[model samples]
Target: MTRSFSWWAALGRTLLCLVFLQSLLGKMGGFGAVAAQMQQRGLPIPAVVLAVSMALMAVGSVLVISGWRQRLGAALLLVFLVPATLVFHTALEDPQERIQLFKNLAIMGGLLLVIDREAPSDRPVRR
Candidate 1:
């Protein structure tokens, strides 16, 4: 690849990686708080469900950050994000939280675009 291409690719990938990391770490660490909030919002299941969501988020985020298993990661993440956007954000009448939810969709869009650009199994993450 040309030097400029390499630079651009690296920059984009790094930004993606940062987003992935932030999401993964946040969900992992914030499951309890998130669960409580969910409970307050009247999720049918127990707060334990949030733990499952956290796990899914962690897996997707890790795959994304590593650029490993891109297709699967994107697929799983979309699965997680769909309900999250709908139940928590869409259900809300507030604009700011909805905006935050939209931000997640935007990140997911970037991830999907990246995954589409690369063959899912072509190469493992270099790092």
Candidate 2:
């Protein structure tokens, strides 16, 4: 790959993980309220769930951003994404929830692409 391509690949990975990064910061900033929201949503042990979610977001985003074990990172995020989408974005009557569901689905598609993608280091260098 050309140097330009490498730079763009890195930027794409970062963009793919931007949502997770921003969400991790948001959750950290509003821990109590977020946990309470989770509790209200019928999640068991909201605090523990929130903590685990935060860990997955932080670690998964880092792994994806760094392009190290990126598939594993995307998988971890998928684990978080599936349930969160089902539990939180299920109100089809609400247009906003509908939008969010589709957005999460789109992110899932991107993450799957990440998982399927060959690592840059694994690719043969072009002359």
Candidate 3:
């Protein structure tokens, strides 16, 4: 039973790793265009935010894929994704936009599932 659980956990982690890695690659490849889009959208701190996000996604994906410090990597990845889901992928009046919006939401839901078993509040907080 334990062995089966381990296998399933590993498979789930692998799926998450692949998704995160591909997303990181896409973001890196289109950094310039994303920055331009941010600017067009009148987003504040466009360049700085994009640069930080690129770093977080790239490095965090690598760590998550390697299963080294996975919890930390997942935490970092969520920081970028939560805001991205709200800011960039919000549902608008267009069908295409709604699809994109739900895509991010779905990804976020997957990430939440793949994260540490205990929610953050379940962890001991140090003063």
Candidate 4:
């Protein structure tokens, strides 16, 4: 790839992870409140779920940003997004919720592209 293309692609990857990274940072600052909110949503073991979600966000963001394991990273984010979108953004009556739902769908689409593009099965196995 050309230098410009590499730079732009890296930027795109970083942008794709921007939301997860931001949320991870926010959750770090308000862990108890976020866990309590998860509990209020009827999630079992809210603290554990929140911790796993945060770990997925952080690790997935790193993997994607570094381009070392893009498929796995994107898949991890997809795992997090599915339940999150359903649990938190399901208030279709609210305009903001509708917007958030569609936004998450778009993000999911991008992650799918990354997974397909970075499929390790398509590459030759290293000895």
| lDDT tens digits, residue span 3-105, model 2 | 2346776788899999989898999999999999999998999999999999998888889888778899999999899999999999999999999999999
Candidate 4 residues lying further than 4 Å off, grouped into runs, are 1-5, 118-127
Clashes in model 1: which pairs?
none
* Candidate achieving the largest lDDT: 4
Name the runs in model 1 displaced over 4 angstroms.
Answer: 1-7, 91-93, 118-127
Per-model TM-score on C-alpha atoms: 0.68, 0.88, 0.72, 0.89
By descending lDDT, how would the candidates be arranged?
4, 2, 3, 1
Q: lDDT tens string, model 4, 3-112? A: 22378778899999999999999999999999999999999999999999999999999999998888899999999999999999999999999999999999999999
lDDT of 4: 0.91
RMSD per candidate (Å) reads 6.2, 3.3, 5.6, 4.2
TM-score comparison, 2 vs 3, better candidate: 2
Q: Which candidate model has the greater TM-score, 1 or 2?
A: 2
Candidate 2 versus the native: TM-score?
0.88
In model 4, the Cα lDDT at residue 111 comes to 94
Q: Positional deviation of 80 in candidate 3, in angstroms?
A: 0.7
lDDT value, candidate 2, whole model: 0.90
Which has the greatest TM-score? 4
Once superposed on the true structure, which residue ranges of model 2 sit more than 4 Å away at CA?
Answer: 1-5, 119-127
